[model samples]
Target: MEHIVNMKSLTTEEMMKIIELAREMKADGIRKLDRTYYVSNLFFEPSTRTKSSFEMAERRLGMEVIPFAPESSSTLKGESLYDTVKTFEAIGLDLVVIRHPRDKYYEQLVDHMDIPLINGGDGSGQHPTQSLLDIFTIYEHFGQFEGLNVTIAGDISHSRVAKSNAESLKRLGANVTFVCPEEWAGEFDYTTDLDAQIENCDVLMLLRVQHERHDGEGLAFSKWEYHRQFGLTLERAERLQKHAIIMHPAPVNRGVEIADELIESPQSKILTQVENGVYVRAAIIKLLLKGRNE
Candidate 1:
């Protein structure tokens, strides 16, 4: 519980504790912390949801958020990640949340820092908080994870969401499946067909096709073709089970990962996932700060 770095390192009890706490906070509004603490967010990549969600979470807990922008900071002058973090620690900040483009970027900081570090994201590596919120959203709907069939579809090779959720969902006793183009499957076993998974899955979790990570390479298929083949078209949406839910770790390419019409569909939990992120993150901060005091 020292660093909220990755899902693989968390025990089932710890994950459940965070989820339950998030649910409680969602039911009863967040209560401010007894003492104000200071935090900073260091995002080296562009973000909307995670950055804003963490800010909302910190404010809800009555924590002071120190604003930081890398372009304006010492990083432009070649300050190392470790050096930057040390600077923040020297400033007496209580905690830090970081999202960097490099994978496992927190590794170097974790051993050297005294303050807790919450990873917002690392390059296609892990997004533990996003995974927790996603888990919280699913639990909110179904009341459990055991034996649930979760199908994760899209850019598996480049999605931190897919990686984090796949490991966590399996650990929590859910049967997990990956659907993606063969080249995008990465190290996981996967099926190319989304249709076959539609009827059985309790959660159809779609990931954005991370074109930014493709290193200037062009997609083999056009958007229409990708949508027809892999995206959740209205035709395919008809096949989902009665109790099944649709999800996306979005910044959704409306016609790419899923149809535009389904974004607000009755079965879609995309917006709920975003809303739950605030409470889930608040719970994480509360627990981590509480753990620090003890």
Candidate 2:
């Protein structure tokens, strides 16, 4: 069984193939994927975009989705994750999508499951599916990944999206840079001067202040200071290249991470990312099922 647990586990060719499939799926519009298979979601963490988008993707692909609500599930009664997953497997689910709040949490379940386990998000670890959809969105806009300067800003230390995007984009030959406060920005290609780097980069990807993780204490800066220094304010937005694009993994922090006005602007690809997410996820689900058949 093939599981998308990490972006680094996929080759550049494989990643590109998924993007190509997503583009085709988008162009082709609605279509049946498989009628017999069932997909399940077990999200231990709270989600709005990823959860809803994955469910939408499953429905579009003709799969009967069993969304496991952890709040009301046996897990709430102190049932072990292993038992819950085993119960699902015993009942004959074809695949499972898990989102846990513990880093490298899939280690406990991956070895035992007969079916594939796709990591929707695993705490401070990588979010491979998000990275794949991000790559698709970037490729759709630029037609290629090579030589594109992609700068990811905000909450780098706690962002699974930043880590996955950095690893995947660099493997595909895009120059990846992290912009954040000195405390959060470590050895990677990093910058504190967001304004200086704004004009040259082809993509300015901003991340949310993940308060849920570490109570948003990654940096000591106040909201105003952080916005003034790193947030994409109106003045900073004007400095972006004509063809540059802005992207964020949704439920944006608004004025704290990015200016509220830029959320709906032409240069912002936030909505486009949300739209492409369904197609990319559909492609991923289709690929994993196809491999099992083969």
Candidate 3:
């Protein structure tokens, strides 16, 4: 079965096709898809954008959805993701949208199931769909990713959104940069190995860290100081390429990673990203649920 766990897992053509389909679906009307489907949202962590978007996407397509929250579901029974996936399989689920707080979180489930799996996110390391919708959403504004300068600032080592965006931008030849401190930088961090990857970048994306997501105060640095060093200050954000865009996956820490002013600025594509997320997810479901036996 096919799965979407990361951006690098898809060819450029495949990625574009999905985004194009999303736009087409948005233009036409979601109710036009003829199918009865059930999608399982197996989110092990808290998420509003991803959860609600996927839910609405399914509804717009005239499909049914089953959701799992840590507090409201059998996950509280200490069910493993493996077992949960099996249960969904037994129930005849068409697809599963999964997320967790571990890096490469879906690696273990890749071969365990027969249905297509759409990875909502795996920890902070690879939210592939978010990055895809991000590019598609930006295209509505800038036309294409070429020559776009996208700077990703914040927890470079952990942000799957940042990781996937860096690769997506690079694959499309957009200049991408990592703006985190040296202590948390890496080859995949978009800073050290990809200096040439960022020059003349056309967009700057910021990632915010939640207090609960951090291990302890000594893990890296205090939240106040993290903001001081790498957070996207208004001045720093303005220094980007003139037409550069600002994007963030929400639940932002105001005044911490991203200044509130920039989030509300015209240059920010944050809200559009959230909106496109629904369309993209609906498109993904169309792909996976199509040709299924009624």
List model 2 lDDT by residue over 109-207, tens digit each.
888888888899999888998899899989988999889999999889888999999899998999988898877764466778888789999999999
lDDT of 3: 0.76
| TM-score between model 2 and native | 0.96
Question: In candidate 3, which residue ranges exceed 4 Å CA deviation?
Answer: 189-200, 218-225, 237-241, 291-294
Per-candidate local distance difference test: 0.94, 0.88, 0.76
Model 1: weakest 10-residue lDDT segment is: 106-115
lDDT of 2 at 279: 90
Instruction: Identify the leading candidate in terms of TM-score.
Output: 1
Superposed on all Cα atoms, the candidates' RMSDs to the truth, in angstroms, are 0.6, 1.5, 3.1
lDDT of 1 by residue, 1-294 (tens): 788999987999999999999989999999999999999999999999999999999999999999999989999998899999999999999999999999999888898988889999999999999999999999999999999999999999999999999889999999999999999999999999999999999999998989999999878999999999899999989999878999998899998889999999999999999999999999999999888889
User: What would the TM-score be for candidate 3 when compared with the true structure?
Assistant: 0.88
User: Candidate 3 residues 82-154, lDDT tens each?
Assistant: 8889889899888888988877878888878788898998876788889889888877778887876677777
**Clashes per candidate (backbone, < 3 Å):** 0, 0, 12
